[model samples]
Target: EPEVTQTPSHQVTQMGQEVILRCVPISNHLYFYWYRQILGQKVEFLVSFYNNEISEKSEIFDDQFSVERPDGSNFTLKIRSTKLEDSAMYFCASRTGLNTEAFFGQGTRLTVV
Candidate 1:
């Protein structure tokens, strides 16, 4: 069985600092996405990437945020400057196709002080 894996299960940072969250998806999956859930809030889609380019993105993925696959196996999300509102559980997901079931990584819980 294939699954997504995330590093640093928990992170604590200052309000103005930067953070990079990492994920590794199943080897054969093509579609990758980043989603987040703020404490007490609903899960929200942040962005989707395919073919090495951004396929879709929510307003939440503004100038402060970026995603990249530095290596073929690792996907990363970088936040240039964190804010209190940026604190959330960030999840990485991937699927083989549009109709396939997406697999999500154990979310990385980020806390900003």
Candidate 2:
């Protein structure tokens, strides 16, 4: 089955550095989302994108974070500046449409020191 794919499964960076988490969602899915899980916490939604625009975003998704499709095949999430609190596992997900199952990538583990 086609699945979402993320790069650099593990990333470690300094507190003030910038990082870009990349993903390639299922080719045919129309809706895409970025989610994060802090160490032991439950998953949290960060943002959703569709039709080449942001459809919705959570309060956790501040100006420091941004998402983009950049091209037909790749989706990305960028953190302007990393913070210790930003350490978490970032996941990329997608669904074909409303009411359908959303598939998630294996996730990128980010360690901000």
Candidate 3:
């Protein structure tokens, strides 16, 4: 079965720096989302995109964060200025439809200092 794939299994960056996490979501999936887990915390939604536009976003997805489908198959999340609190596993998820099961990437672990 096809699955979402994330680049750089781990990343370490300094605070105030910028980072762009990349993901290649399932080709046929229509909905794409970004979620994060802060070490031991539950996964929190960041943003959802469909039809090349943001469908919904959580308050956590502030101006500092952005998502884009730079191409037909790539979904990416960029953190403008990294923060120590941003350290966590960021997951890329995609589903064929609202009710369909979502496929998640292995995740990119970001550690900011």
Candidate 4:
């Protein structure tokens, strides 16, 4: 099966630095979403985007975080200031349906040092 690719699969940085996680969602899908798993916690939705703008976002997607589709195949999430609580597996997923099964990338592990 085809897979979504992410760059810098793992990153470690000091706690106040900025970080951008990159992903290439499935080419044919219509909906894009960002989710994170903090340690062993359940996957939590951060945001969803479509039609070139944000469609929805959760409380976790606060002022510090933003997302964009920089090119034909790249989607990125930028965190203006990292926190220790930000250490988690950030996953990028895309689906044809808004509330159905989604294909998830292996994830970019962000570690706040």
Candidate 5:
């Protein structure tokens, strides 16, 4: 079976630094999304991408954040300037269609000091 894969399962960074989290979803999946769970907090949807453009985004995905499918295989999330609040387990998800179940990657745990 296919599954999403994320790199650098753990990352530590300075409060004001930048970070890029990478993921590779199932080959045939179409809809891709980014979500995050802050320690002791509920999981939150950050953004969704389809057809090479952003389909939906939460307020959390502000000017500091961006997503890209740089090579049609790798999906990346970039945070321009990290903050303490930005520390969380970021998950990448994908689905075959609108109504299909989403498959999520093993989250990348980000820690900012």
Candidate 6:
């Protein structure tokens, strides 16, 4: 089965640097989303994109964040300015339905110091 793939299983960055988390969503899927979970906190939605534009975004997706599909298979989330609070497991997901099962990439653990 085709699956979403995220790189750098873990990332360590300085508090003020930029970081780009990457993913390759499942083929034939239409919607893409980004969600994160603090060490022990609930999973929070960051943003969702469809047809190359943002479909929805949560408050957590502030000015510092952006998403893009640079190629037929690659999707990425870039944090312009990282913060200590940004340390979390960032998950990339994709689903075909507007509201349905989202296949999650294992996750890219980002740690800001």
Q: Provide the overall lDDT of each model, using Cα atoms, as 2-decimal numbers.
A: 0.96, 0.96, 0.97, 0.92, 0.98, 0.95
- Candidate 6: pairs in clash: none
Worst 10 residues of 1 by lDDT: 1-10
Over 45-87, each residue of candidate 2 has an lDDT whose tens digit, in order, gives 9999999999999999999999999888899999999999999
Reference-based lDDT, residue 108, model 1: 99
lDDT (Cα, tens digit) per residue for candidate 3, span 1-113: 78899998999999999999999999999999999999989999999999999999999999999999988999999999999999999999999999999999999999999
Stretches of candidate 4 exceeding 4 Å from the true structure: none
lDDT digits (tens) for residues 8-94 of candidate 1: 899999998999999999999999999999988999999999999999999999999999987999999999999999999999999
Off by over 4 Å in 6: none
How far is each candidate from the true structure, as Cα RMSD in Å? 0.6, 0.5, 0.5, 1.2, 0.5, 0.8
lDDT-sorted candidate list, best first: 5, 3, 2, 1, 6, 4
Report residue 88 deviation for candidate 2 (angstroms): 0.2
Give a tens-digit lDDT track for model 4, residues 19-39. Answer: 999999888877888999999
Candidate 3 C-alpha RMSD relative to the actual structure = 0.5
Candidate 2 achieves a global lDDT of: 0.96
Model 5 misses residue 80 by how many Å? Answer: 0.3
Backbone clashes, candidate 4: 0
lDDT value, candidate 4, whole model:
0.92
Candidate 1 clashes: the total is 0
Assess the local accuracy of residue 26 in candidate 1 as a C-alpha lDDT between 0 and 100.
93
Error of 1 at 107 (Å): 0.4
TM-score of 6: 0.97
Model 5: pairs clashing at backbone N, Cα or C within 3 Å: none
